[model samples]
Target: MESQLQQLVRHTRVHEIVGDVIRVHATGVALGDLAEVQNTDDEISLARVIALDRNLASLQVFAGGKGLSTDATVRFLGRPLDVVYSPNILGRIFRGSGEPMDGGPDLSTEPRVKVGGPTVNPVMRVMPTKMIETGIPMIDLFNCLVESQKIPIFSIAGEPHSELLARIGFQANADVLVFGGLGLIFDDYYFFRTAFEEHGVFARTVMFVNQASDPLVERLLVPDMALAVAEKFAVEENKRVLVLLTDMTAYADAMKEIGVAQERIPAVRGYMGDLYTQLAQRYEKACDFKGAGSVTILTVTTMPGDDVTHPVPDNTGYITEGQFYLHGGIIDPFGSLSRLKQHVIGKATREDHSQIMNAMVRLYSEAVEAQRKQAMAFELSPFDQKLLRFGTLFRERFMDIRISMPVTEALDLCWKTLAECFEPQELLMKQALVEKYFPKDVGPVAVNEAPIHG
Candidate 1:
């Protein structure tokens, strides 16, 4: 007869192994609990309880499920996946598993917080009304990134998406930044670290990196771990936290791969059926606390072959507030939008911000049409000549991704650009705004010398 403790322990051999998942016939197993799988050779692999039905539990092993037989033992650890959370975590780099990789001191004594926890309640969420400025002209002047807004960078392969993300991470005005890198190559990862260190923002940043060479199963955990720590800072420490996740498409790919291995029914593009819900669970973490701080999420979701209809970006568009479309190494002003921007424009910024934004984009549109006419060998009218000149100045001064300045300076530059291209009467802005902002002299007003009125 077996002892009472032996019977209660419920150690069992693996029933089946498929790809990176193992099925164990065990009782009293809960979802998300950590487990230890030991093979006949006593080699151990860490796994998590992903699905549980009746007496069978499906576990995703961090290490690939290769060379494993039915004789492998599965022992339940009786805990969910938790990551170390403390002040020390900042200025340190960690693997996707939340283990420190920066050659720094171990964070063994720090408080461990469970990853993939529930998002903040809707009742506790406050309406986002503050702008998180990144000093990028296109973002600040056109589509301002609002606090608690979840947005993605829509880009294709061979774009400078990573560089753009690094610039925001280094320049965004936030209390703390949590960066999560999923399926990034070694060069990209190095670029992010080097950029952060060189720009001197590494001290307030915590990174959870899942490199291309790391276990594919770990790619699924990076976003959750980064957001978990960010939530702790926002709710407990009362710090405004900004979470940056790069290449969520890779995360979805990992999910699809695991789904196939588990024999699950496929949805669109060979993805799981609950793809939208899965993405919402992560993006909804962006929240502004009622009386405390906020967590703003900015992610990069690559469109495979630049197809917006792809499952990953298609699903993302539904969850996020808006997207920044990156093309031709610049943020496409016409393609990008922020739904929450109206909540802060003119209220948190200068009085003329909203009007200036509308007028500049409208003229820029006309300029584009004028260029199209010019391309077809049509005779350019006097107004068309003015539009053409405006377009060139707008692209170089405002649309270019390299232009970085404060919001106030950006507003001033807008006036200068408009004044250089058109007279005050042709601007079609509000009479008072045009008279106040339109430069009196021919030369462009110095950036900070212009006086702004409410």
Candidate 2:
């Protein structure tokens, strides 16, 4: 019976154009089948019927239209946007849309999997305690990277965030590095690739990058694609995976695009209301699979206008364990924190690790105050003089992100630097620690005078 009315097949897959993206579900179609998409607003594009669907068909429309008439054809794509996946892709780079950008040959039907899917089960979770050291004192010495910990480097434009990520990729003691670069300019992408190749770590790393010129929607798929590959490696190959996702703000902006497309109601700062849930779904992927390897996510979330309360960073702060704040060409000691460091610092490191770390920071903080006093032309006490010295050396030696050293060497260097600046009593450290770490005065002050220059 050919009736004028065609019922949307019951139990057929449906997708809601909510949240700027319409995700397909088996029964989601039934919910909006009666719904019609019409070009009510001049801004919305009128969707053309592509196919009639019970199972999957194909649907491509001109312009993203809000008032989609139910009478409009909704031919399905038979599947979600499938992404190619294979172990042979371990050391490759790809565009945001999952196309190889590394000038490699086509994957040639190795098999493709969809990105941006649901997370693994929580019951399969394992507590985090393992440490992935980058050999950079600012990170390894202070904010220790724990296995399966999800963290962010909060920064703005022009920070060495990209270089820092590259350093970690090369130095971190992890089996795999899966980097998802979202919305990077050409030079930025070029830097990462060159850095990895120069260090000869390209064989162990993989990148999924979305550049500034690519379609905006493609940016949304990068992190998910990178993570998807990471998850597979961990569960199947038991590889210790370190996933680095840069410029999360780009991902957030993409979310906003799809949200507006679905005509979804906006939440704080014009982002979709489900911001937290979306971030959590991605970050919660950091975990140690039982009897297998782990996944640790370290991401870049650039603060727009340097405002921490900018909706993107504000929400990310809640999701990640803590942040490494990059400012003023340095990883700010005060702003950077590792909430999970408590679990691994003393346990995974040396016995005096906690004490030395705390004491060093306390001394550095005092040094800052001394420097400020010096700037005000205040008379410098002997202690102030010592602190001022310590602060100068601290910034040059430890605080500089470019300074890389083993954790033990860093501690030893700390002791040496302190001893050179002040007497043992002035340090006020535990006598036992002094006795062990303090260098003995072997000789009097050296006289290397090239005839005193006035």
RMSD of 1: 4.4
Q: Candidate 2's error at 400, in angstroms?
A: 1.6
Per-model lDDT: 0.89, 0.74
Count of clashing pairs, candidate 1: 0
Residue lDDT tens for model 2, 387-451: 76677767778876778898889888878777867788877788888888788863222222121
The Cα error of candidate 2 at residue 67, in Å, is: 19
What TM value does model 1 have?
0.95
- Give candidate 2 regions above 4 Å deviation: 1-75, 441-454
What C-alpha lDDT, on a 0 to 100 scale, does residue 97 get in candidate 2? 61
- TM per candidate: 0.95, 0.82
